[model samples]
Target: MKKIPVYLFLFLLLAGCSLSNVQHNEELEDAIYLIVSDENNDKLSLNSMTTFDWDKAYLFTPYSTQESITEQLGVDFKDPSDIDWRDDIYLLVFLDSDQVIQYAELERQGADFSIGEKQYLTPTDDIINIKHD
Candidate 1:
């Protein structure tokens, strides 16, 4: 009976450690964000199921090669470091509940703008119209 109790305790301890590791991995995974833009450089879109109010738009970081910011955005982005257009200016589009969108520019820092790992969070709706220049 004592041996049986000892085995049970060991099994529980191992299970707890495994669960903790899994949770840590999940936290790391959630820390990245992917910023996707079109060829026109109009707006950046994210495949996220979570909806945000118009007021929350400013809180989002523009898609860029910055690994730290991208990580905090909870996106999995591709490494955008090697691309030639690293100096190019990029815009971020914010959409409102009424479908109205706004734009903001992202400045380049040398070859700093690289896309990181990409993971799809949710399905995004198609664009209707983009008015910015």
Candidate 2:
């Protein structure tokens, strides 16, 4: 009976330690953002894309851009590992100070750009014009 309790305690302790690897960021500190399923969002490399990772997900925070992505390659994400993200465009998510979340896709149409259709978490009466430089 004593060994049973000790094993139970050890199992619980190890399980808690294993759960520590889970990462989650609930706050945003930037005007533009991108979320993807990958670590190393540290901006360690420029234009260096990492391989697809389904084990973990990461979000790019506080990003702004002057250029844009005008076109997007149609993808069904059938094989997430094989999905090719648009290098010229980004799915910029705007989280206003009011915590109003808007989904916008930035596209680079030559020298000009456009923001994708706006979406909201809840119904809002205000116009959402999420612009970037």
Q: Which residue pairs does candidate 2 place in steric collision?
A: 30-62, 66-133, 68-107, 68-108, 69-107, 69-108, 70-107, 70-108
Question: How would you encode candidate 1's per-residue C-alpha lDDT over 14-127 as one tens digit per residue?
Answer: 997754321112221122222223334433343342344332222222334445534544433233332223434433333354232333344332212222332211234322
lDDT at residue 43 of model 1 (Cα atoms) = 35
| RMSD vs true structure, all candidates | 13.2, 16.8
Q: What CA RMSD would candidate 1 show?
A: 13.2
Residue range 73-131, candidate 2, lDDT tens digits = 12111111111343444343323333213233433222222222423221222222233
TM-score versus the correct structure, for each prediction: 0.22, 0.23
> Number of clashes in every candidate structure?
19, 8
List candidate 1 segments past 4 Å from native: 1-52, 55-87, 111-133
The TM-score that candidate 1 achieves is 0.22
